[model samples]
Target: METRQEAVTGTIGCATAVLGAFAGIAVWFPYGRTALFGAFEGETNPTDLWLGLPVLALGGAATAVAVLTAVQGRRRIAVGLAAATAALAAFGYAFDVLAAPQALQDCGSPC
Candidate 1:
């Protein structure tokens, strides 16, 4: 007897988890030296590798939980997880947009 809302939330949560995982991987294995390059594209920086690894792990875990909860008919939990994931995604994207220019400016080419 799962509600439609719960199903939707579960789906969203799963999507968010996937997105987060990708973002985390990108951060950890950046293709470029600067965050700006990596933000929009697939760039990696050795120095920041450590920082991104944890995010990747967390994203994967969250995604797993969301999927499990959804499957178990825990609609409320799934929805909450999805909402949180959406919020995090939104904030991360915003930060990338706002921070890109600054990162580029700081690095000054070859970034």
Candidate 2:
């Protein structure tokens, strides 16, 4: 049986993680992908930077919280949420590297 405080922490952590994941995915299509690739090539878009910053910040914060919850609660659900949060945070980079190599190369100023 979990205490109320533990439950609350788990809930907040889960919600934050979900929100962060959603924000990351939502921005990735319109701004994140191009922004990220452009950054690699020294041609970042202002719009992408503006949009990506907050999303990345949220994801980082959420991941931290989820990890904290998992460690503090020592519960299976909390652990699962932490793992899911981490995976979601990594999904965009994975997609870019594995599935969108051509797209990345196409972005940024002509060489």
Candidate 3:
């Protein structure tokens, strides 16, 4: 017998986690080589794809867990997933901001 507040909170947390995961994935994967070229005007590295795939998978799992917890009305679990999503999102952003530029730099012109 969960309270309405708990249910609402759980739903909100799940939504937050889902959105965060999507954002993290976007930053991690970008849009293949074309998108990378449009943004940074350089050759994209295969190594980046290797590194980002695992992060995207982990974020996807976190989002799924959040959704499941919300559906089950598990407020605490939903909240924990939401917090993990936030941390992952932050880490993804930091990795993109710091690592992306260096990788692009390595591409040189016409990358």
Candidate 4:
């Protein structure tokens, strides 16, 4: 049985996780697309460390806290958050490890 406080915490955690995941995806989308397709399109997409690095760091922190909260009291929400967080983490990883590098490479000497 979950107390009211626990329920509220879980709810907030779930919501935060969802929002964080959405935010992560939102931030990654443009860069990811540019990195993946810009070269072929004859356009150079440069990675913005200023914007991307902070968002990824913050989103990661938020997701970690949310997952901890959900695991403490809400099994159902935990599962959902786990999936969402996984996707967010994977997407972030791809953006950082693969996409960013590709984008940088595409930039040549001027980026």
Estimate TM-scores for all models: 0.44, 0.37, 0.50, 0.43
lDDT of 4 by residue, 7-110 (tens): 99768767765676576656666665665455553554455444454556456546766567566776776677567667756765765632544435556676
Q: Which digits, one per residue and each the tens of the lDDT, describe model 3 over residues 52-100?
A: 6556656776877776777878899889987887786686666653255
Q: By lDDT, is 3 or 4 better?
A: 3
lDDT of 1 by residue, 27-98 (tens): 544422354246434443433333335544465556566766788798999888777666655654543422
For all candidates in order, the CA lDDT equals: 0.56, 0.58, 0.63, 0.60
The TM-score that candidate 3 achieves is 0.50
TM-score of predicted structure 4: 0.43
Ranking by lDDT: 3, 4, 2, 1
Q: Which window of 10 residues has the lowest lDDT sum in candidate 1?
A: 95-104
Model 4, residue 57: distance off in Å is: 10
lDDT of model 2, residue 74? 57
Which of the two candidates, 3 or 4, achieves a greater TM-score against the reference?
Answer: 3
CA lDDT of 7 in candidate 1?
A: 95
